[model samples]
Target: MLIGEVARRSGVSTRMLRHYDSLGLVRPTGRTVGGYREYSEEDIRRIFHVESLRSLGLSLRQISRALADPAFAPASLVGDLIRRTEERLKREQELLDRLRAVDASAPFDWRGVLRIVELLHGLGSPDAARRQQTVLTPAEDAPVPAEVLAEAVLAEADPYVAGALRWALARAGADGVASLAAGVRSEHAEIRRRAVRALAELPGDEATAALADALGDSDPAVHRHAALALGARGTTTAVPTLVRMIVEGTNDVEAAEVLGTLAADPERTDRLMSALAAELAAPTADSAVRIRLAQALAEMPATSAHGLLRQLAHDEDRAVAAIASALVRAAEQRPQG
Candidate 1:
């Protein structure tokens, strides 16, 4: 077939076919009597193969190596193409995300768009201090989006920068809650921990609910932090977690103090006392555990804890007995409620 016929049938543009010849990807198998390029059936087949490889995102140079070198492994080249395509896709996605974030602000003009892009770049900067400044004192005219702050908060590892991100995120309000909440469920332990910690600072029912969900996290650190934050928020749901913390001797003192403050509630009095008294009676309550529980019990109101204190005052464990005795003595001097 002549070059024109091959171009028509194979859908390979004549210019591109000439370029392919220059690169030796596919050369015409013969020359016509008039000296025009002519392609044999095999040459046409090679042209189709080159087009097929190009469809797989193979570069012209790679296609040349693939078609000419039998020793060239398609598997390795395809793997490389897959990786490069994935990288390109990732960049495109990031760019699309930036544009969407800018659009989300409903920017008034080019300047507004520019402000958001600049803020995003600052947040994503390699310098932690630059990120901190971007969040800590964002331009007054260019409001930072909550999702942006939440993303930065989840990714920041610098202690100071992370603190700033959380502070900014809280100011952004409940809008950031969903993003932070997603971070709470992340499989990466560090991200999950940071997510919950940031969520803990954010006020709103959404953040509180997220913290409550985190109470069941498999990581002890995550659950403990969530429980402490929840306890501070006066969420009754945190009671069981705080009790567990005391028993495990992890931040037992703080847990005990929060529990003490919680027990001041008349409704929680009975449940709180019962929880401590049961732990004291548990066979698993070793001396150290018993001592921590005894100290926690002392935090309860004198009226609520008096009977439990009396029982522990003469306990077989001297340290436990001593803590109960000292608190009982102190309770005696106070006026009855």
Candidate 2:
């Protein structure tokens, strides 16, 4: 086959075939009387092989080495190709995401598009201060999309940056709730924890519902943050998690305060008091646990809590009795509401 016939059959252009020959990648096996390049069957097969390798993202140099160097191991080269392809895919996906975010923001002009692109880049910056500035600085002209903020809020690790991201998401409002909710279900424990904390800062029923759903998360930290948020929202579902937080002494003080808020509702007050009383009565409930429960009871104002406090005041455990007695005396001294 001649070069033209080879190009027509193998889908390799004549120009490329000549370039391949110049690089000594695939030289025609013979030439006709007119001195035109002629390709043998084996030469055409090598051309097809080079094309196939190029399709797999192999550079011309790599392909030449792969075809000619008997010592070149394919396994390592294939692994390298895989890694490079994956990196390229990651970059493309990030670009697609940025474009989608920009389009979703409905930028009015090139400047608007540039602003959002800048903000997105800033949010993903490795420098924590840069990420903070991305959230803190508000463009009166072009606002960053809420989805972008939500994504940052979920992935952020720096304490200060995370706080700023949460504030930005909250300011963005319900728009970021869906993203934050997805974060709540993330398999990563830290992500789930950060997600709920950010959700707690957001307003609206969506965020509240997400927090309520997070109350059942297996991570105690997740449950603590969700319960605190739900309790403040006056949701009864947070009662159990709030009580558990108190017993575990993890943010027990804030948990008790939120429980006190939840207890303001008459219907919920009994349930909250009963949960505390039951935990205190558990045989496995150690003295420290009992003392935390007694401290929590001081925050509850319901009549049921008063009765439980009275019972605890005379308990056999000296430390438990002392704390409970102090709570009761303090309650007695209060001018009855």
lDDT winner: 1
Query: Model 1 Cα displacement at 109 (Å)?
Result: 1.9
Superposed Cα RMSD, model 1? 2.3
Worst 10 residues of 2 by lDDT: 297-306
Return the TM-score for each candidate structure.
0.91, 0.93
Q: Note the residue pairs that clash in candidate 1.
A: none
Tens-digit lDDT track for model 1 on 1-337? 8878888998989899999988888888788899877898899889889999899998899888877788887888878888999999998988887887888788898998899999999988899889888888898888889888887788889999999988888887889888899999999989989999998898888899999989999999999999989988888889888999999999999999999888888998899888888888888988788778878877898888888888888989898789878888988987776
Candidate 1 residue runs with Cα over 4 Å from true position: 323-337
**Candidate 1, TM-score vs. the true structure?**
0.91
